[model samples]
Target chain A: MCGIVGLFLKKDDLRPQLGDMLTDMLITMTDRGPDSAGIAIYGPETEGMVKITVQSDSPETAFAHLDAALCAAIDAPVTIKVIDTHAVLTVPEASEAAAIAWLEETGLRIMGSGASMEIYKEVGLPKDVAARFGLREMGGSHGIGHTRMATESAVTTMGAHPFSTADDQCLVHNGSLSNHNQMRRTLARKGVFTRSENDTEVGAAYISSRIAEGATLGEALEGTIKDLDGFFTFVTGTRNGFGVVRDPIACKPAVMAETEDYVAFASEYRAFADLPGIEAARVWEPEPATVYFWER
Target chain B: MTTTLDMTATDLRAVNTTLQAAARAQANEDYEIINPRGAHAMACGLDGPLTVTIKGSTGYYCAGMNKEATVTVEGSAGPGVAENMMSGIVTIEGDASQYAGATGHGGLLNIKGNASSRCGISMKGIDIVVHGNIGHMSAFMAQKGNLVVLGDAGDALGDSLYEARLFVRGSVKSLGADCIEKEMRPEHLEILAKLLEQAGADAKPEEFKRYGSARKLYNFNIDHADEY
Candidate 1:
């Protein structure tokens, strides 16, 4: 089992509350999946690195190469944080075209990227992970987080989520994707690269490529329902807004509560309990094979 | 001591207050729960000779850490009820949810009605007796336990399993990997009778059948690895 959440903040005034609020939500779901935690945030006007996260078996070896290659790779200095097997770095702001290239070439296989989308992840408890990324006081209008149990792939940072596509769109998942290898083969044919064995990454890239073309988040999500097999509850973070989707069976659990201030979704209700005055917020399961999207 | 809870109140603090008050008012070794709501995680980790008689339905993980305590529910239960019970007795008067006796190390679970999937999954050493129909994967991965299903069973029963004795009286959809049907011996019948008596069951000894592991998964070999 895994816990996933995404938020679309309608009001800019609520941006400052995003990190703390999302952190609280992630903490509540710690029990569902405790292997690792990851987050991706997107803002309308920010120029951010489509960040790529990876965890090499040896952090020391990984860091030496990262530090040496920072100057040759991008135009600006690299901002990086390291702990244990996990690490995150901001690849100084780059254009959509350059960002895409930088993401694919990161020393680690490009499982996903957060650009204009601030991505954060760590290998520990939800709150501990947020603390590792200094998320407690940080603020953003839209973001997503995941706690993974690793039913399909080995529990590693490389396999953890918030997968990206087309260097812009990012996606997180709560259930298994049955048609993973088939989807990967198709994406590979289109020159889209996949880094990890995780099936969610393929789906993320699939959505990212679609949004890059012209389809809206909802259309791309609904389109994948028939193509992507197996049980899946997805939360996508996009430039315009955030959206959620579920597979036909709804075998995985997901509940969403939309308030005047924010739209929050989680695998369970306990995670979103601290959303100011939103006590037990009318939590209801999202319909199977349905997708919901909104932006403000 | 007999105490009942109101169904309207969702807050456990109010209901706990009643249970605590009843425990304080009565000095007897056995206690009774008169009216229970759809409360979850009830009577978790309780000890001593207290007997909790739930009057109505309950939610998830009731009597989770039952020690010397004995809890009897008058109605059905939600998921994970009696999960990880260490030692004691948990009796359900009606149907039980999935993982009815999941990972229970030691205890006696008596289900009078149907039981959902994974009824005795990952049981450590507990004894569970279900009087009616049971769902799929009834003993999926049970490590050590005595499971008695007096009715029909479903597919993958005892799949990828461990040392657990399963007794079913009706049709079994399918047996899991390395699992096979066993004989109902006189000694095993006596053991079943003792378990039934603990569960407050009054069924005849002849009305049961036995099923368990073939022990093929215990040893490792190139040919058998794929079967696992």
Candidate 2:
């Protein structure tokens, strides 16, 4: 079993509390998935700059002098902020591809790259991972967190969820996909590749490929219900939208609550018990094979 | 007197142990649980007469295996609420998650709001009344009892059923294998009326249609062996 929690703030005032709220929500779901935890926060954005989140086993050595070296190599200004094993490198938007290539050549694993999103994940308990990243102090407009129990792959750092395959687009899943191996081959033939052996990463790559082919976020999520087999309750995020969808046979539990201020999704109601104004939110379970999306 | 147990202050095991002891001793007391916060398995395994009112929502398996105890959740419930219940009544003021009242033996499970998939699956002699719609694969392999729905039923309702009576006031998307629409006889109406009254449902019994097993797949004939 896995736990997924997503929060989309409709009001600008709640942006500062997004990380704190999401941290509590993710920790409450510790029992649902204790193998690993991850979070993707869509924080403040800078014009003409892109953020590339990368993780290294030895951040002290790998990150040292990395920004200066990348700046000189790409001939563009690069600033890296290290948080635990992960670092967010902000580079010129025009030089993102070059920066990513150079960073990849350095053997650093790219977690995600986007205009505003920063992804952090590790193999540990949810509370420990949250503490390691100081997740409670961060702020964002929206975010998605995942606690994984590792059904389809090993419990490694790469297996942790909030798998991001495209810029500012990520997905966290609660159920196992039965046809991921077959689907992985189909995507590979289309020039789309996944980094990890995790089934959820394949799901993420599939969504990213669909979006790259000019599908909307809602349409890409709807395609999952038709193409992907087995049970799944997926919560996906983009630059300006958050989407949710469940498979036809929705054995995996999902509960959503929407107030005037925010839209929240979780694998269970317990994850939402402490949200602000939750006592009066319009809470309901998303129907099977239906795509529900909220856009800014 | 109504004893209050605050879950935020006392742990879940201690609270459940207190309620279980009350049931075993037949304390016949009223207990109010506060700050449930969607905790799983709240007030389970009771065997005697008692009254439990959970102030907020609960997690999985709430009021499971109940006997002679009337447990009420003032808010919603998670999965497997009242599962395997033996007797007495369990009520939910709000919606219930998947597999509500699954494999229950006896007593009444009244969900005032919607119930997700697999409601009353493999139920044996239990009576469940859902005021709102139920999801797919409900009452699959149900043995005996009554499932009354005041609203619509999702796809594949009552698949592979066995003797359980299903009454729906609204539309049914589809019926499962070995399940078909059955005539509403006077005896069936009698059962429906009693359950509706006990569940505090306002729907009239005459507005419903009954469904049950066709009994074709029960015996496994050689002609249908390839289909299986």
Which candidate achieves the best DockQ against the true structure? Answer: 2
lDDT of 1 by residue, B110-162 (tens): 99988866788889898999998777777888889899888889778888778
Q: Model 2, range A195-219, lDDT digits (tens) per residue?
A: 9998899999999999999998888
Off by over 4 Å in 2: B226-228
List, residue by residue over B1-228, the lDDT tens digit for candidate 2: 999999999999999999999988897899999999999999999999999999999999999999999999999999999999999999999999999999999999999999998999999999999999999999999999999999999999999999999999999999999999999999999999999999989999999999999998788699876986
List each candidate's DockQ score.
0.04, 0.82
lDDT of 1 by residue, A1-296 (tens): 89897776768888888888888878777887788888876643435544545455566876665743664566565656564455556665553345436544655544344555656665677777778676767677788889988887877666777776655477889888888899899988878877778888889878876766788778899888988888788998876678888876455656677777778887764565467645423434465577888875
Could you give the CAPRI-style class of model 2?
A: high
- What are the runs in model 1 whose C-alpha is more than 4 Å off? A47-115, A280-282, B1-228
